[model samples]
Target: MDAQPSGRAMVSRGTDTFCATDGRPATHLPVFDGSLPIMTEQPMVIEDSYTGHVSPGSAPQRRTVPGATITKMSVGPMDNNVYLVVCSATGKSVLIDAANEADRVNQLIGEHAPSLDLIVTTHQHGDHWLALEDVAAATRVDTAAHPLDADALPVRPDRLLDDGDTVTVGEVTLDVIHLAGHTPGSVALALTEAGGGRTHLFTGDSLFPGGVGKTADADKFASLLTDVETKLFDRYGDDTVVYPGHGDDTTLGAERPHLGEWRERGW
Candidate 1:
């Protein structure tokens, strides 16, 4: 993956631009030898229908990494995934997505109820920010997002995040990687705990379990692929755990080999 071809990468979403959170690595998701086997039951899933209460038949999924505790919940009619990244040391947490179901999104703060530091919108997609205003108002946490998508959001961000900006939650600090394609101003976060530990990445919809997020055309797909390959796959280790906006989680190692396939398909 070290063959760097020199050229300008085309990455953007709608009229916006791209840029890319945080947590510790959970149990190592091993990269398969030949056949890829997707792991489904390690991290506990939170069963709140985003109604400020748990669903009758779902369980909460929590995973702890080096310096952070992570919780993933699927919310809204679109089944978007919202994540809570809690700093283990200070108990301060950052909420990502808040895609829908305002009540359910509020209840996910958990019983311990860490101090809510920030609400982040991965991009300006309507599904991703449907509950943005509600969640921000309820929690009173300042919002942060890339400037490109900031105007598209219902609530104006307190801080406009750019690539390379560091968002700190307690002792955890994350590097922003701008990945513009599915929507401009789309970003992913990278968290490496103290002493260069394995990184935990919260990728909104830029990169997913099997492929990059949906793109409108060949050029857009190319822009997305270029950024994911150069910024994410080329930079992060195979052990990096990726919690996407929807569906199951996967590791960079598991998804790296399939990049060629996704590119060839032009999606």
Candidate 2:
């Protein structure tokens, strides 16, 4: 798991390069014990198909996902993607990655907030959670995130979310995933909108179009890719769209064609 042990290029997905898979502590998912688990990184599955809607906003564009309305917000030094996940049926919403711009977060929440069910952070990084306090203060809702990243919040989470945990916004449910590459606490969310059987993954920093997250710790990097290959790729088809923390959104299929190359690059 430690950076593939010598960066030996593995022949995978028609590419030749050393992909980073550092076997960091965060990367290693815990073995399920009988008792209440200290940390969980299991991938969640959607139980039902529901419809969701994203209210039109200043962004001027609203896209629809399997069972939810997807509103994309441009935020952060990296222009980190912030998503307003709302369920159409019950009008419940979840805020993803409130990285700074407190005023904007407040404004959006005040104007279009729908029950503000949960505030989900991608990781503990400053850029991804700068405005977490403001958003939480304004909405007075519970927060959900990877076990490792929960400490980033000003207030501890009311409850902790594991990989398989399901978060509901209105009627829509998002499955939690711990990718844990960009940081020990890195996580992802997967959900399907109505009318479409396809799934979408919000891969915070574990994955990007043609690059993987870089890591100084080889162990951590290995854990990241292992989860990506097994938990993410095994469960989700190449067709699933990848909404990353920064940069343009891409699909698993789109990235698959370049997985080997990306791995070698040690992104």
Candidate 3:
């Protein structure tokens, strides 16, 4: 057994290989010993199927898809999830929600992608952009956010994103979906594969695993829920994966059935 920097242990037992993190064993896979019937081809592995859990001082998790690779890390006292999306073909990358801990964010960017192109603030929340100024200055990357929340940011956004607007990272294109309620300018970025393989939604604070984000009043809640239903649930399919600003991830299918419950509970 060998220990990894990410607090994970790689173990090889008999003809099986697996990883254990925090004393939790991962899925086991068959390994070939010095025996006959050796597999000629490598087994298909899905690295993107992560549990989306990160601690303040822990290593980040990476998920690679067809066109892009996403790196997720948690920072600050609020446990904000900062995501870095890098285009596979061009190496162009974008950082979403610089959140907090500028040193950590800058270090990760330097290690993974030194030439970060853009830093996108999902909204004007203080927790989301705590490290925005420092990271942007360190990387010298352009910033983007919804116009409604632009004034609240530490720095003005180079590009003001509106609903249905598109932001490109190399060959990959991200569609901006304006989800009002959590904040006036709360937005989500949706990236769909070329052949419609899977649509990834990076929903800052608008959507989450159990329900939509918090709203100030009943009116705001209504607007948020309606917009989420019409724009998100109605437009996307069940397989669409949702990455929120905080905590773990979920799919549209997992939260679709609870829309009515959310509406009734008035949260």
Candidate 4:
């Protein structure tokens, strides 16, 4: 998918990465250590507002959603992909980036898995948090956001999260990581789902379908890119599906092609 400019300020995460920092393009997958804890409920709004539709994204060839599953759903805009991470056995669930469409998000989860228990935010953008109230209204779940971003909330988060912490819902466990570039308070979710069959990451604006988020810190952004390529890419590979802040779903494999160009051009 090609990138489009939304109306709001395009905040750059900076050039802290070695790969795909040019903003050319790369399908990104998050590499994570299952360490951060998840508190379960969360909320955001748009300052640099973007208005568009979310795409269905690449249909997963096969899903573990029904089996040892971690079900994810996209809501808001053109379905900005809100995720429902569920443990098939225990029926415990968490919501990620409900966006401005929490109603749709909850419907999907309530229909598919009934025991949802948490909500999370990847960053402080408006689209990510707007529908959070609706989601909370539907479910009596605890909400969570990074401690750095805890103040951005319209409502106090049930939990204030930081790096390397862990939160559990039934059997599903999620780890939180703070990559503060998108908003000085943005964070990402790294979780081991389905009894740790594999690891998954819900990177907010930190990384996108084909590129990392935009920020003012070019050097730091470049290093973040490097961390993705050398560290995250090397570990996660192209197979891992990286659920991003906006746009289509991507795999590290799809993103690998754009790395060199991003690094050289230096966005």
Expressed as tens digits, the lDDT of each residue in 1-267 for candidate 1 is 011112121212233322211121333334568687654323334543323222222554677778887777776656677888889989998888878776566666634335879998898888887877777776677999999999988899999999889999999898999998888789999888667988988889899878999988888889989999999999999999888887778899999999999998887
Per-residue lDDT tens digits for candidate 4, residues 49-106, read: 2222234432211136322354444444454666666676787777787675444455
lDDT head-to-head 2 vs 4, winner: 2
Cα lDDT for residue 143, model 4?
A: 90
In terms of lDDT, the poorest run of 10 residues in model 2 is 1-10
Q: Against the correct fold, how does model 3 do in TM-score? A: 0.81
Candidates sorted on lDDT, descending: 3, 1, 2, 4
User: Candidate 1, 95: how far from true, in Å?
Assistant: 0.4
Comparing candidate 1 with candidate 4, which one achieves the higher TM-score? 1
Q: List the residue pairs that clash in candidate 3.
A: none
Candidate 1 stretches with Cα past 4 Å from truth are 1-57, 110-112
lDDT of each residue in 122-183, candidate 3, tens digit only:
98888898878777776777999999999988889999999999989898899999999999
Looking at candidate 3, what is the lDDT of residue 183?
A: 94
Per TM-score, the best of the predicted structures is: 3
Better of 2 and 4 by TM-score: 2
Superior by lDDT: candidate 1 or candidate 4: 1
- Candidate 4 structure lDDT: 0.61
Overall lDDT per candidate, in order of appearance: 0.76, 0.67, 0.82, 0.61
Models, CA RMSD each: 16.9, 19.5, 12.3, 17.4
Q: What would you estimate as the lDDT of candidate 2?
A: 0.67
Clashing pairs counted in every model: 19, 26, 0, 58
